[model samples]
Target: MYIPAAFRSDDPDLAWQLVEDIRFGCLISGGLGLMASHLPFMVERGDAVRLVGHVARANPQWKELEASPVLVNFLGPNTHISPSWYTTSPRAPTWNYVAVQVRGRVRVTEDRETLRRMVLDLSALMEPDGSPWEAAKLDIAYIDKLLPGIVGFAIEVDHVDVQLRLSQQNNADDQRKVRAALGAGSLRERQVAETMTRYLGRLPE
Candidate 1:
């Protein structure tokens, strides 16, 4: 991702937070050609950052992983910033958003234990109030029947590129105006505005 200094963020914690905030991501890989899959991934951070997710057995994207590096894109709230909201005259419209790109080599797995854990962990992450669902709740026969239809993989994250374009290039006064304009828009726009507000507050003026 091409990021200007004002919009670039190298904070590892923030990058991981973005992944947690946006559970869904696009996994891009190329071998014979470019292939992408939208998936909900769980992040595991220890000695290294790893992303675990699965694709349908019918999806050909999994077969290409060994031949290509993977790029996972986690996108956060984004909204259009109208130039009309800027205090500066002759300003052009721009987008205010946050996104993180994780690049790494992928290792595919079909082991029963690994697959089972992957499913359970994914379920736990998506549920509220500390995840009530358990993999054991399902019949073993049913799980066995379903297991072969999917393939799981883990990407050992080697690089994380973060971009946070939240009106940082503008003055504080103009930033407030932009936030107000966005807040008055749709729910998603308001979300984007809130992220901008929080991020801007952390910066030194």
Candidate 2:
């Protein structure tokens, strides 16, 4: 999260969009000697910004939240930029990517209704065209039986850090070369290239 001024993104809306686009993240807590859980998050924006997610009851990471704040890491498209791709010599190889880190206070909720809502909302987010499998379609008895196996939680965000290291420090020619190299590669590489082109406007119009 050590973002240089040139790489830092001060736009909260952009950060939120990144979080939503890449819903899966690592939730980390240090009170229990550094415990982390990879979970798919659902963001809520309103009077108080919150991240809602659930962890398996068997996973002890949620238990540590009681003693510590959590850091959620949302990593977007990334690629390795070779020095050879640059227009000039004497350039060091580096990485280009977009990432957002959210620091927040977490609260574990065990309420059955809340857990059910969280699950439904998460399903909606994951599904291609909204989930056809609504909780209302499921048997209440089955849902009740499954509720005890998981723990729902919400994190009230304290701060957010967004970084887009897309060769902003490079000159226009070098950046264009990097973008071309990346876009000519795999699908993921192409995505990183597109993001750089879109956000930094380094590519010619």
Candidate 3:
């Protein structure tokens, strides 16, 4: 998360949007010599913001939470920016991307109600339009049987680091060039280009 002044972002709304946009993140924890679990999370904002997710109880990472520290990192649209695309001569290649880190120690729980609500809430977040697996329609007996295998946790958001390196350091002409080049590239590149476009007029000249 070493972000330059040009790339650093502190907008809380943007950070939350990015986290929700890319719900999947790498939960990093230390003390067992560093462990990571890739999990889909639901962002909770109230008196305090927290990232909620779960993992199998057997996953050793869960057991280490109390003894270790934790943080979750989410990555958004990213693309490789070729040096050839830039008008600036003598420039090396670089990546244009968005990344966020939610830093806090996780409070792990195995309470049946909490776990149930977590599963339901996660389902709803992933499927906002509603689904056949909606919490109410789901079989309670089956859910109960399955709940024991997993543990839920909520990471209180103590700090957030948002990085938006969408070619902001370059001049306007070079930014346009990168955008146009990416616009014609793959879908992922197109997405990165779009994000860059959104920030164009808003960022300083």
Candidate 4:
């Protein structure tokens, strides 16, 4: 979470967007020797924002949520930037990526209703539009039976760190070259390229 001044993203809205856009993230409990769980998260914004998710009840990580400070890490599009792609000489290979880190204390819930609601909301977030399968369609009895096996939790955010390392340190020419190289690569790379254009503004071709 070390962010240089050049790479630091101070925009809260953009950070929230990243968390929502990439809903899947790692929930880490530092109160438990840094134990971690991979989970899908939902952003609850209001007077106080919250990060919500669930884990298997048997997962020991849940015990740590209330006992210690927690962190949620979300990674967006990323790509390797080869030194060869830079217009500037002597530049070493590096990465172009978007990452968000949230730190806070957590609150866990065992209520069946809350768990059910969390599941339904998560399914809606994950499912593509017009998909036939839906959580609401599942039998309530079955859902209730299954709910006992899981635990739902929410993290009240203490702080957030957003890093957008999109070659902001590079000169425009080198950045443009990196963007062009990224544009020619995978979907993720193309996403990085697109972000560069959007955030850094249009440059001379």
Candidate 5:
């Protein structure tokens, strides 16, 4: 992630919030070919940050991980900004966004007990309201039958790159114009615009 100072997000708490908000991530690893898997992840922070997730044991990407490090990308809201929305003279269109990338070594956990715990924790985190569903909802016998089909892994993050480009380079008038235009445009664009509004106050003049 090439983030200029104008678009850098260095706040650790904000970085973790983005990770939690965007639970789904793309896990990429390089080897014989570029391998990628889209998976839901749980962020664990203690002595270090660890990303936990699971995939089908049959996935070829899992087999190739022992040979190299893996990179996980968590993408937040992003939107296209039309040059027409800017207060200044015509400019080339660009994108405004936020994304976090984690680079780490992958370690597969084969232990069924650990995998089961990981699955339960993921479920709880995903449904924090205590809304319905339980780890025990699945028939124990049936779950045992399914457990063998999957494998769990934890990526200990050695490095993280976070980028937040929310029209920070633009003046307040231009930023407001972009936000108002995007907010009324489309669903995705509106969401990004809303995020920009929230973080816009933090940007320097």
Candidate 6:
């Protein structure tokens, strides 16, 4: 990710929060060819950051990942900015948003025990409110039958890049205008805009 100095985010906690908030991420690997997989990820703390996830065994992306550097993209809320919404003269439209990218080496794990543990940990993270579903509640035989169909892996993060482009380059007036336009738009767009407002400290009118 090419982040300008004005839009760069250096807060590790905020970056991790974004990653947790957006569970789905794209795993990109560069090798004989560029391969990518859209998968849900779990973040674990260790000597280095640990990312765990799985993909269908049929997916070819997993085969090319051995000893290769992989990039996982965690995209947060974002909104399209219309040039017409700016207070200044017309300019090209752009996106206002926040995203984090984790670059690391990919390691595939086939151990059934490890896979089962990963699945249970992922469940807990996704349902922290103590949902009805628990790992032990499932039938062991049924769970065992399904384990072979998927491939699990962990990425030991080498570096992380976080970018928050909330119109930091724009003046107060222009940012306010953009925020207003976004907040008045669709629900999803408005939600993202509100987040930007809070993070950038743009007072609501």
Among these predictions, the greatest lDDT belongs to 1
- Per-residue error for 179 in candidate 5, Å, reads 1.2
Runs in model 4 lying further than 4 Å from the true structure? 201-205
Give the per-residue lDDT digits (tens) of candidate 4, residues 72-105.
8998888888999986688787898888999988
> For residues 1-205, could you state the per-residue lDDT of candidate 2 as single tens digits?
7988888877887878889988999999998788888889999999889999999999988788878888999998999999999878898889999899999998999999999888877776687766566555777788788889999999999899998899888888998889999999999899999888777853222
Candidate 5 structure quality by residue, lDDT tens digits, 66-184: 67888999898998889999879869999988899989998888798888888778876787576777775867677667779889999988888888889889887998899899889
Poorest stretch of ten by lDDT in candidate 5: 196-205
The superposed Cα distance between candidate 2 and the true structure at residue 9, in angstroms, equals 1.0
Question: Model 1, residue 191: what's the lDDT?
Answer: 99
Clashes of 6: 0
Task: Give the Cα lDDT of each candidate.
Answer: 0.88, 0.87, 0.87, 0.87, 0.85, 0.83
- lDDT at residue 119 of model 5 (Cα atoms): 77
* lDDT at position 197, candidate 3: 80
Off by over 4 Å in 2: 130-136, 201-205
**Pairs with backbone N, CA or C atoms under 3 Å apart (clashes), candidate 2:** none
Query: What would you estimate as the lDDT of candidate 5?
Result: 0.85
Q: Candidate 1, after superposition: displacement of residue 36 in Å?
A: 0.5
Q: Candidate 3, residues 1-205: lDDT per residue as tens digits?
A: 7988888877888889888888999999996778999999998899999899999998988988867568888998998999999887999988999899988878999999999999887876677574555666788898889899999999988899988898889887998899999999999999998888875555444
> Model 3's lDDT to the true fold?
0.87
Clashing pairs in 3: none
- Model 1: per-residue Cα lDDT at residue 165: 90
Work out the TM-score per prediction.
0.93, 0.91, 0.92, 0.92, 0.92, 0.88
